[model samples]
Target: MTEPAAAPARPLRRDVAAALLVLVVWLVPISEGAIQAAPAAWWPTIVRDLGSISCLFRHRPESVSYYFVQVLRSGRREWEAIDERALFPMEPFGYRSRFDRFMERFGHRSDAARLDLARWLAARDRELDPARSPVVAVRFLAGAQRIDRARPPAGRWHKPDPGAAPVRVLSSHDLRESDRKDMSEETGKSR
Candidate 1:
């Protein structure tokens, strides 16, 4: 029998092309993250879009630093820690971290963002356990770790200072109807 007509060259070419395409698709996010790490003024539009797209693929904890929500029940001096993950679950397809979303939407010091955060927390509290004490206030704490670039990357990480004061990002009291209206108006004006 004639040496089985050497496997069709066309199929081999197609397989190689498909492998390349898959590689490119996976590399897009990694490339974007690398570019973002060292931002430049001349980045092209495609690169910028890729950076946003990369959020769906990678979690940049460095960018997030540290953020937490503190919940104080009515008449309580001590605050309970509410984990960000409990509020926002990771999407199956997207790489967006809950902390990132929390910071973007409600981490700001503005009155509107605070009120919104408080309302959300109150609602969540009610949903979780109606018998629990009502949430009187919600506060956000944000802190950034100072990285030393000169140190070697591995084992050079520095934990956040235990004695360092946490930045109070947002604080809001139990919202009344009038306060809610004011917040709505403020939001409308800002938009």
Candidate 2:
């Protein structure tokens, strides 16, 4: 048992080598993730080649501590005026993993009050209901890549309900204000 434990450390000698080992063991595959996790360009190519994960050193726990508070300590909260930026922006899958781990660690020990709080949070999930949360509604509606409100064929005109916003007849995300103005001028209200 002692020999096996020592052998594992022997294979992970250098700082970079150890970092790669951790990533290989912990980094979930992108296809199995909600967000794409990729290595930053600054990460060692050799490490990336060995582990098949993002070579990003900035957020890799091997390069730094794994605690969120520690990351905040190392970054904005600690060095407030440095104007540093992340080498690789983190995404939702990593967050999911972190939250799952947190729940696993503490869910059992939580009191009735804590359990009730969790239930309340679940009831208020904005993703499942937009009307109850205007902020979530705005973010979701406004961030859509393209809204296809094109009239269904010429003869099948459908009247808009009074409650609905004016349906966009023809609008592309590529169009600028000037383009919209020009089109509005050329085609009147129909466009």
Candidate 3:
């Protein structure tokens, strides 16, 4: 059989440039992570456009945390967990519920915002089920369970155990007091 001709070899300069490009692409991300994690700022920003690069990828998956809302009705002794879907009926996706996201942002909100949220919840509770006692108080709860990274998740839907994980009350407000104050303010304004 006739011998097939060998393919032309790439130039040494071209090969070196290609290798350097690959090296730079890989190193930029590593350098970025080091720069962000450490206090030192040794990485040169002029070389790579780190500003444009999203920090979402840099987020290290922390412990699995869950946020939920509970309501204290006028006559009920025990707090009832509000159904997230019912509360946020317009929410399209379930990866994160609207109520949960609200709770996440709730930490940074002011006292006035808390009262607004409490008032909204109280009104919403009555609207959701008029037969049930009106919500006298609203409480936001947060719980986090340290996930073992080594182990695979048991199920697609993992319910964070309220019993196993320590539940924290992020904010609690008495709607009754707020309502009374609001009424008094309205009367005072009228006078």
Candidate 4:
């Protein structure tokens, strides 16, 4: 019986240098462009490059945190400048940041929502009586599907606060061509 030869170990310094070099090369364009177009677009590649550098160098690196902070700051500034030129806003980034902040500050809210949902589930536990609760039956109909639930008409769905003053709010949607004409005519009368 013959034993297979073990693979030779790669040079640690060379691997680290190579990894760092690769990371630098990869991040220069993506991070720079992402900061202007989408600040968050930098994150995926940044994390990947950072991880690669970390793996190739230290088993327990200390500079990882420093590098991350530096990169984040630079990327943030670049993104701020880039965002000024953006015509359309990126909503997901705002939502993600909001959720992150919420999670950080009110960690309890998530738990509360979870517990509330669980309590609701428990109240509607199926073991007691399967048919007592409302039944939901979904099927694909051929021509026209009937909607059973009661809902407000289109414009009513997005109403403002009830207690607030009843001033008509302008919305891009739900406004007719006649409505625009009326507004313009009213403006002309005031002028």
Top candidate, metric lDDT: 3
Model 1: weakest 10-residue lDDT segment is: 55-64
TM-score of each: 0.50, 0.17, 0.62, 0.16
Candidate 3 local lDDT, residue 1: 100
**Top model by TM-score, which number?**
3
Query: Model 4: per-residue lDDT, tens digit, 140-164?
Result: 1011122334632343222122224
Question: Which prediction has more favorable TM-score, 1 or 4?
Answer: 1
Q: How many residue pairs clash in each candidate?
A: 0, 2, 0, 1
Tens-digit per-residue lDDT, 1-191, candidate 2: 45554444444368878787576644533322224345333545444344443543333232111111101111122211111113113334343233323333343234443334333333344344545421111000001112234622344322223224322211111113334666788888565
In candidate 2, residue 43 scores what lDDT?
Answer: 46
- Comparing candidate 2 with candidate 4, which one achieves the higher lDDT? 4
Error of 2 at 125 (Å): 1.4
Question: Which ten-residue region of model 3 has the weakest summed lDDT?
Answer: 38-47
Cα displacement (Å) at residue 75, model 1: 2.9
Which sections of candidate 3 miss by over 4 Å?
A: 1-56, 90-94, 107-111, 152-164, 189-191
